[model samples]
Target: MKAKPCENILGLAMGSEQSRLRQQLVAASMGMVTTHVLGVCVQLKICDLLRDEPLAISELARVTGTQPEPLRELLIILASLDVVTIEEEAVALKPSGRLLLADQTGNVVQWVQYAAEFCAPAWMELADVLLGIPPAAGSKRRIYDALSSKRYPAEIFHGAMQDTQVEISATLAEAIRLNPGEVVADLGAGQSSFLIELLMRYPNTSAIAFDRFSDFTAMKQLAHAQGVAGRLQTIRGSFLDPLPFRVDVIVFKNVLADWSMEHLKRILTMARQGLNPDGRMYIATTFVHDPPSPDEAVVSLNLRVLTEGGDRSEVDYVAIAKEAGFELTRQERVAAIMILEFSLKGTA
Candidate 1:
């Protein structure tokens, strides 16, 4: 019996769908492998070495301290990925590969390294995390705790945060309107990149970087390098404790999402006490959309949840701020982050 035309068409459509599904699965699996491969490239400074010119496979292996055969295999993989070009037994960095260099303007080497080394392992335990089991590092320890305790590489983590914040900080500096000579305090400011950007833009303003375990020496060096050292100060203490002094503006960039709602409220309440009578607070964080679009924000929320802290929607943020004795005054979305401005309830 021969199939009818309609039945044959349906069979073809089904076959196409199955093929598409298979392709999707393979792509996802390969994505996981590619992440670690990129991490290894960054760790070995392969792109940096290839920046000026191509290198013979043996020479590359000698410099990188890897066996030539394995190095060639890796280079072949990178060539296939379009991150490098290989010909005549030599490998050269591609334009895309240049973006992995440490000194590049928009480099993502640290972010890729941090994601592969720290976040990827946590993601592997996502199924168990959904089932209420914490990440394997320890159930009781949060990511920040691990950073403070030296379990994770603090410099790389902070550098990754700086990489992620560069554009957002520029956007925020333009979005914010700071008065001349106003004092700004950034709680949990890792390397004070945002504050440095703000200080550079608003020359008359001064800023404070407050955190319990930041590399203050590096922060000062960065500030000095940026020529903002005269206007920026460092305060070493936990934000959970009372702020050492009052300021006109309090900024929370990528901080609150790491904590639970109760802690968020408590932190806001403490922050409120440290604000001047007419002070304003700004929180820059990734907010979960109401309908939850499958984008970077959602991906960030998933990673946050896997580590036992997750993002919330704008409605939830408003409610939480109200509970903390503050009211939302304005909100703006910059890339995947939201900069929410708030003031004490009933303030003029």
Candidate 2:
């Protein structure tokens, strides 16, 4: 058999299909590596070791009180992912991993655990989620609703919310430009991640953080623990109702993805009405590729959307804003969340 030679760019691309396939395999393999490293880091507390000095595996075992042999293997594997390194006589977190997989008093270690606890089991049902009506994970029904009970989801949901909020709040601080002089309203602000972080960053600003009445007690304690107690005001109400106060900025952090586009727009419309003319609106949440298309998160989010039915793209959201008389200023990615900014036309 004779091999065909490339004549033009398209011809070259056609010959490179194998490379594309290899690229996909590499991408998928990276995800598997990430999942594996997460599990071991939690057990070995590799981040804890890196917290002090670059400890050797033996010392890590001593500090954490685990066997060195297993920890050595774990560190070696972690080294491959650059989550940790086994250098000369010490193990340490790589710079990139340090930002995420670490606990320096502020840790989202639970999200890694969430990945393992909720997602790993769901992946097992991927075959079903992809083909069947819908898997338990993708339904808009909360874990409690799908499981036909409320106890389990409530117990773990807040922890997951807090864990997810920690990482999200960090990135949002950078992505969202705010004025310390301006008052801010946090809608659906579970645990008030924004209020806690802002109190430390902006001395002049005060926040009116709102969430479900059910979440008030715990969120109150969290606000105090973050040391923003004086500046933090918890407003108890559902987002569907009128905000009791007016503010310069309103943030819907990680709230939109749970809804259908129509419902989402309705909520944004309601939010727009509550804002001062010069007020700014900020929404942050993550989304998967067109959800009807095949995706890992489809099972979980699909059900969630069905319940509220509002996860949408920038275009869809912008269209909604236009309909509601607000202008879409910009959309950008921050970590896994999409940050959307809006303003009332003719206002700041």
Candidate 3:
């Protein structure tokens, strides 16, 4: 067989592209070491300590109760990652490093910490799980399943989720309008970030927060902190079961992505029956194909490891909603999160 000249050129180009992709994969694999480095720094409060000002390695090690030489090596790795800057013998936080401060409302430190400690183990065995390998490590469960079974504290898992949700609470609060006396319910309200924001923004409004009892302690604390405690009602149960009461608006903020499609449909169906005559449901989640795609891809993979579920498209949600006798009324994208509005088939 004789190959055409253009075919040979095309084959060479394809081969070159595949080689480049392989090199990129190798580079990405190296990022795991950096991830663990950042995880160690966060676990040791290194970033929090450096947030105020530059600190000498010796002082930082002393304060964090870490050995100096090992701490210095970690700091050097952080400097290489641009998380911190090394000047003379002191290390100071870079702008990006400020986000790791423990007190920062929306921080990635806990998220990274949770991933390194909990998710990474399961992620390492993902191929085993996918291949249905026998229980070498005992019955393998996804990260959320582990949390659900009380294998890991819910506080750590939910805290990590709240770390990210804090950034979008304000934006989500603005995406919906509430009349002075309208009622709202947040299904699976992990920390009540959304409910608290709504109550704060619309002083005349009241909210129902439903989740496990363990998750409500933080919600109560958050509501008290936000000075909206009196306006908030806490319900303890799984949203998978029927909601006890109805509301004028029901919210599934940042929750649907963690649910399987069957579960999503069941929840939406319950939301349908749980709504008042003129009620609406707002579903806020990171949709499948939003902008700044690299982060989205990473988040999707993480969610998949945790729940065996990840981001889904508008079409997917709409179809699920329609099956549940609801219709998609509107969708608004704020930051990387998408807020989808649904109404009963006959309602506006």
Best by lDDT: 1
Q: Count the backbone clashes (under 3 Å) in each candidate.
A: 0, 15, 0
For model 1, the stretches where C-alpha displacement exceeds 4 angstroms are: 1-20, 135-141, 216-219, 286-288, 333-337
lDDT of 2 at 20: 58
Q: Which candidate is the best by TM-score?
A: 1
TM-score for each candidate, following the candidate numbering: 0.86, 0.57, 0.79
lDDT of 3 by residue, 217-289 (tens): 8788878988999999988787878889989999877778877898988988888888998889888776566
Name the regions of candidate 2 deviating beyond 4 angstroms.
1-155, 213-219, 287-306
Give per-residue lDDT, candidate 3, residue 219: 83
Error of 3 at 42 (Å): 2.0
For model 3, give the RMSD to the true fold.
7.9
Among residues 3 or more apart in sequence or in different chains, the pairs in candidate 1 whose N, CA or C atoms overlap within 3 Å are none
Question: lDDT of model 1 at residue 198?
Answer: 86
CA lDDT for candidate 3: 0.77
Worst ten in a row by lDDT for model 3: 2-11
